[model samples]
Target: ALLKEMHAAGFEPNAATYNALLGDALQVGDFDQAWHIVDVMETTGPGIDFYTISILFKGYKGKRHSMDAASFDRTLGLIQTYSVKVDEVLVNVALEACVSLRDPHRLSATLATFKQCGWTLPKQCAMHTYATLIKAYGQTRQLDHAWKLWSEVTERKGLTPSEQLYGQMIDVLVTNNRLDDALQLFEEMKDVHGEHLDSQGFAVAYAMIIKGYAQQKECTKALQCYDQMKEHGTRLGLVVFNSLIDACSRVGDMDAAARLFR
Candidate 1:
């Protein structure tokens, strides 16, 4: 019905018409046709403005985190060209795209721009965002990037790295065979009195470091770290001690392993 009007009115289907049709198609999950309509408008460009581009982004925001970077660039261009006021929701939506896509390159860029625009992220949410980026990198065995961001998290994240984040880095460092650095990271996570510092910090940081070192066949370092843990008045869970025993057994130090396991 509307197609007939578009055909008769000779309006040439500008961005507004494209957006309205896209919305209707999306409402019924007619996604393939929705994309087709968007592409048609893009091909017929210069008339596509911020509101139109933003409408398309709204449609794809959750479904495709790592969409064609070009699409986001086009949308951002629309925002700039139209002098649209930026807001937290917009920045967050961009970040959400980064998280789902795990595209650190663009995510990092967006985070910087978000700060430049005077958007203050909540401490908790910022930690999660950074952690998510790091974890995604770690999953891909991209330790260099992961550690680089981990350094930023510790030095300037405006919040203590959560136990989970710290644990993730420890795992990555161990994977990269950089056991000493991992142990040092674990130490930095400690507080003045030598406690694990934050709630459950030891559970993730200390325990994971020990496990990683053991897996790396560097049981000595693991034991050394365990001793340090005791000196700091942190209670060692029996499972942690058992892990050390297992490490010793793997290296033919059965006596030491047996002694601890006992």
Candidate 2:
């Protein structure tokens, strides 16, 4: 209605005005309306810019399940179609979408497309970006790729790994049945960032390691990890507690299992 009023008043809405409307649509999860705005912009109003592409990508971040390959490809096609100069923010949003989608093929294709568009992945990105890429690789069972990325970040001069990054790497390692590696990394993390272990973020990593050990029937090791977690004052959630109980039952330690159950 407001747009109609503007049109009747002989006021032209530029790309920024349309971009704001598109953002509002996306914010309300009105993807249909957002696309309509994009279509109108493409046909009559100001052409799409990098911000437009970024907004679209950000909008899809939460609605990744609705984003199929065709939709993703069309979004990518816009960059070439409009000669949109990809910026770091846009690249990060793309990476996030790839992570949320958990499609390795799409992730690989996106990176390849970015390369073709002359934006190479930097040796170092924001730690959250690295964590998201690591998770995408991990979810796709690309353990080596995930590990290689972890090593790259650690080896970067003077760049301390964020706690979130460590948690992600630990998760990848634990999920891959590399409990020993995960434990070593956990210990290293404790030594470096021990004071911060009490945070709930690290608690999830601890739970992963405990669950890994439990799955392997290494109940004793699982219990040891639980003890360490307690020692570090990490919050024990139901997942960890349940893993400990199961680990005890697996080892025929009914007494311990009963104690954990309580």
Candidate 3:
């Protein structure tokens, strides 16, 4: 009715006006109405832009709290159907929703759609997006895929992998009982991105390594990692120190444990 009145008044609704109407429709869970507004926008010129895409994505995200998995997917379907272009931001939004839902099938489908749309993964894809996908793959025990994405993000894309990503990769390797690979990646992170790392980041990496070695009952290597952490001037947290002491105790090196405790 409002749109009808606006059209009758010779007031041609632009994208903003249409977006406003879309928001109102989505607010009430009227996805059909929302898509209709999007259709109007596309047909009337001033077609959907990034901002419009963002608004639609955000609306789906907001609705997820109350919507079931099927409903969430339907709302997202509208974006895929109506999106003018699938840029990195839009892809991130879709991936994010999939992650939150833990929908691996949806993730695979979204990537397939991304390719079908002739959208290559943007070189400037944000690190968080890479991290999220890596994590999603890791959780599914697809370690190879995780590492491939990591390499592309850091090497081909030339984006510096964050300490969080490094830590996540180390944890994934360690969890999968690939201790040697974990150690290698641990050292590689420090070597390749050492200058980019802060003390806390180094601490996180060292703690993961120390915990990994300790879990494997390799007290000597765990101690080596602890010493390395100190040498790097990383502020060791109490949890890491406890892990080191536990490693010593596990190896019946009470003297070393006592020294650490003191």
Winning model by TM-score:
2
The digit string of per-residue lDDT tens for model 3 on 214-239 reads 88888998888777776767788986
Reference-based TM-score of each model: 0.46, 0.83, 0.59
Clashes in predicted model 1: 0
lDDT of 2 by residue, 1-262 (tens): 6678989999999989999999898888887898889898999989999989998888777654455566567788899899898766788787776666667687888777777889855754788878877887787788998988887887745577888888889888887888889889988888888888888778988898888888788888888888877888899999898998888888888787777646
Q: Against the unseen true structure, what C-alpha lDDT does each candidate score?
A: 0.65, 0.82, 0.75
In terms of TM-score, which candidate is stronger, 1 or 2? Answer: 2
lDDT of 1: 0.65
**Tens digit per residue, CA lDDT, model 1, 1-262:** 5756877987565566777887776556566787677566656543555456555566675454344676666556555555555564565455555456646576666556555555664555555566655665665567887877876766666456776677667766776777788877767666422444434556657777777767877788778877867766556877578779767867978787766645
Query: Clashing residue pairs, candidate 1?
Result: none
Off by over 4 Å in 3: 1-12, 20-50, 59-68, 123-126, 153-160, 171-179, 192-262
Question: Could you give me the TM-score of model 1 versus the true structure?
Answer: 0.46
- 1 against 2, candidate with superior lDDT: 2
